[model samples]
Target: MKILSAFLMLLLPALVFGAEQTLVLDVSGHCGSCKKRIEKTVKAVDGTSSADWNKRTKKLTVSFDDEKTNKDAIVNAVLKVGHDADGKTADNEAYSNLPDCCQYRDE
Candidate 1:
């Protein structure tokens, strides 16, 4: 019937556009430059369609193709750039290499 057809039409787009999953990452660092660095690193990953890092909350939002990449890979990329993400510890070599202003250590 007409009502059934209209209902199906309305539901179709939602079904098509629904994301498989949404990943909310906690990234540690401060300042706008940190945001840019994290976002840029995440965006470089092949399956990431979009990435954003918030300086205020130290959170990174990433949308990626699950089939092509995964959460661990994304987290590692940020870690490699001297940022702590997804609960993983930062890489010592990468952390030591960051500019002084970008360093989060107390020392």
Candidate 2:
């Protein structure tokens, strides 16, 4: 019984401190400023641990705590900041409002 109790104690932390989830999603933008914007937008979401945007790949890789936020939430946040994510496009007004240098697709 004592041995079983010790094993459960060792396993408890793992259950409580769940592993961080990593998700990579397509995000559209151009230039260094775009990279900064996308990453910053994702990181602003509650529970997001980190965000990386690749200019060449146009992929946004984010690490976040699933318990507090999900992929959809992160994607929406990115969209709100005027970036395209997955199949969701940014709000037209917001997209159009981005600085000329940050625009990825022509209007």
Give me the displacement of residue 38 in model 2, in angstroms. 0.7
What TM-score goes with each of the models? Answer: 0.79, 0.90
lDDT of 2: 0.90
Instruction: Give the whole-model CA lDDT for all candidates, comma-separated.
Output: 0.85, 0.90
Worst 10 residues of 1 by lDDT: 13-22
lDDT of 2 by residue, 38-95 (tens): 8888889999999999999988899988888999999999888888899898999989
| TM-score for predicted model 2 compared with the true structure | 0.90
Tell me the spans in candidate 1 whose CA falls farther than 4 Å from its real position.
1-20
TM-score, candidate 1, is 0.79
